[model samples]
Target: MNQVTRYSPLDDLFRGFFVKPMDFPSGMPAQQIKVDVKEQPDAYLVHAELPGAKKEDIHVEIEGNQVSIRSEVKQERDVKEGERLLRSERYFGQVSRAFQLPYELDEGQSSASFKDGVLELKLAKKLAQPASKRLDIA
Candidate 1:
């Protein structure tokens, strides 16, 4: 079955006026860690977007088929001698995203890297092993 929908201009104009905004008191919108995952034959590739985050502040964890990413973005407090502060629009807080994959990940073989405000992960898939082996009589 197919359904048709109609677009209204008025709905777009007042979309968020009725609902509460996610912005903070400083007028900065809440930041979220965005991620993209790709599946290969033997591994899963992940690319996470974490702007203004230091490499040391980002953490990734894998448990079986579950994967989680976390990062902390701290607001810099540097001001030049002759510069006056006007306004700031950057977000400062922790953001995290977690998800589950189809196959279990091999934590020993998985790797991660961060560059240009982007986090890349190469998660290797765990190979299936036999549950039990026959034992010979002593």
Candidate 2:
């Protein structure tokens, strides 16, 4: 005997309830901050692409071996005299990405630069040191 399964639309909707829906203009997907990490002998080099984002709006943070990057993009239009606005569109978005490396980073030595929509991070590795010390009885 063969068992039959029933088809339900509600089941499909509920199955992907937690997943975000993909919507883009003209079938083109939204752009994100693309990142590439290269591990060196004593440092890590990271290159991230943030299009249409200003350098002042980008931020980077490091915690232990984890690295987080956040950027905001905003677009505006200004109309001059004798120019009637037809359809105006303004876009504002925020994108963030976080990842972990094999070694911790030295915040004091690390440096970051942004140029031509590309962000470069030179992360220096933190030297390992003994964390525990001998305790004396009071």
Tell me, by lDDT, which candidate is best: 1
Q: Put down candidate 2 lDDT per residue, 42-99, tens digits, no spaces.
A: 9999999998899999999999999999988887777899998765344468889999
**Alpha-carbon local distance difference test for all models:** 0.92, 0.88
The list of candidate 2 runs beyond 4 A from truth reads: 1-28, 78-91, 131-138
In candidate 1, where is summed lDDT lowest over 10 consecutive residues? 20-29
lDDT for residue 90 in candidate 2, whole number 0-100: 48
Cα lDDT over the full model 1: 0.92
TM-score to native of every candidate shown: 0.71, 0.65
Q: Each model's number of backbone clashes?
A: 0, 0
Please give, for residues 20-95, the per-residue lDDT of candidate 1 as tens digits.
6455464566899888999999999999999999999999999999999999999998899999876777789999
Task: At residue 71, give the lDDT of candidate 2.
Answer: 88
Quality of model 2 by C-alpha lDDT:
0.88
Model 2 steric clash pairs? none
